[model samples]
Target: MWIATLALCLDEDYELIDLMEQMKREAGVRENCFASLGWLLHAKGEYEKARSYVQQLLNEHSLLDEPAIRLCYSILGGVATAFKEYDESLIYCQHVLKLCQKCGEDAPLPVAYQDIGEAYYWKKDYDLALEYEQKALDLLPEEHLQRSYIYRVIARVYRATYHYDLSLSYHQKVLDIQKKHLHENHLDFAAAYNSIAAVYHNMRLYEKALGYLNKALSICKKSLPVNHPDTQRIERNILRTINHYNRKRQYKVSNIILLYYLKSLKSDLPDTEHETCSILVRFLFDGVM
Candidate 1:
């Protein structure tokens, strides 16, 4: 369990999945492997597969002990968050919290708080998000690596609320910890780079944003599956940064006419409008305005 948890913290999804699968094969469903697998699958962006596995566990909820039940609820909470069912996520996470309280286990308390914090974060309840995330952070020792996860959640909430400096600080803290603990090419570095890039992007530091995003993309290509969602997301982010940078450049009459032409095609080809525009922008401008 510790290994799986640590693998997740490091964003080592491939290794985590393999470990969970091996656990499942050895121990079957009774060892909480299914619950762990569900959670890990969600981390890998296999949401439908995660839901299917976890829903199966839910079907057998009556047979589960309190710890197993809590685990299942925690996994469900994460899946709900991925689906943007924030209210449902909160309910599940709250249930996990209540279970953790009943167990009187300090070890599990932070996870419950973190889960609730994430749900609130996605709901755009930044104050509640920070409140719960701070509770989670307070539970950990200052040097505990797990604190990085809480820091990341807080950092994202700060970013969303336009607290860029605070966001960057927290993200840098995550990097500091990762640098101390993880291998140089670990996927967590890629995540941290992507997050820092987002801060720069929001600050309108387009060149800095592109530089960090390219660093992140390079890391992803080396560490993650070629078709991984994180890799795809970084690719999309690069394109978006390039487009945003180009749009802010002084436009000639030809550029204005070209944009108008694309806009006019939206109504005529609604389904392909975005793709058409993106392709045209890349082709006509050679990725520069």
Candidate 2:
């Protein structure tokens, strides 16, 4: 369970899935592997699979009225948040908080706060997000793996608020901890690269953004499942950065027009069309696209 939890914290979704599957087979449905498995699928952007798992857990456990039952609610919140179902996520978070109130200020108390904060963060309410995240940070122990993830969230909040330097500082803290505590080439490291790239992009440091984006893409290619949404996102970021960089040079208008057309196609097309566009774009740019 610790291994699976740690993998999830590090954004190692594939590893978490494998671990949870083995744990479920060995320990059976009596354990909390179901919730962990559901959360892992949510992290992987497999919303339908995650929803089914959460539903199974809910059907089996919702009426139990135990502290353990709160785990089901927490996972429902997580899955909903992954799907951007913020209102539903908040209701589930409230359910978990009510259970925490009944059980005293135990571990889930902090987690409930964090979950609520996550929902707020996704809604672009950075102030409320920071408040709850600080509440969670206060409760989480210094060395817990969850603190690293919370730090990343806080970093993102800072970024969204336009505090770029502060965001970079916090992201650096997360990256340092990940390097110290997690295995090399972990997806969290890739995520850190992507976050920094976004900040650089916003700052109009195109070359720096491109460097971090390439690092992220390299890590995703080696570490994540093929065709993962995360990989596609990074590839899209790379193309955006390249297009932005090209916009400044004279004689680049034709290329820019082509790339802009491809971008429009990418936004409007299905995944199959996007894949075809990617191939065409690559052919036009000698694989740079």
- Top-lDDT candidate index: 1
Native-to-model Cα distance after best TM-score fit, residue 57 in candidate 2, in Å: 2.2
Residue 53 C-alpha lDDT in model 2: 64
Candidate 1 lDDT over 1-289, as tens digits, reads 6435544553554544544454344323344344665666665677777777777777877656676677778778877877889999999999999889988754388878988898899989989998999899888888676677788888999899999999999998998887776666667778888888999899988889999899999987876555878889999999999887766664554486587666767666665766666665666567443
TM for candidate 1 is 0.73
CA deviation > 4 Å runs, candidate 1: 1-32, 62-65, 251-289
Clashing pairs in 1: none
> What C-alpha lDDT does candidate 1 achieve relative to the native structure?
0.77
TM-score (all chains, Cα) for each model: 0.73, 0.70
Q: Write the per-residue lDDT of candidate 2 for residues 1-289, one digit (tens) a residue.
A: 5435544553554454554454344323344444655655655667777677667667777434465467667767877876678889888998888888888645467777887787888888899989988998998777666677788889889889899999999888888777777666667778889999998988888899999999989988876567877889999999999888776442255476477656867486777867766666666567343
Clashes of each: 0, 0
Among these predictions, the greatest TM-score belongs to 1
Model 2 residue runs over 4 Å out of place are 1-32, 62-68, 249-289
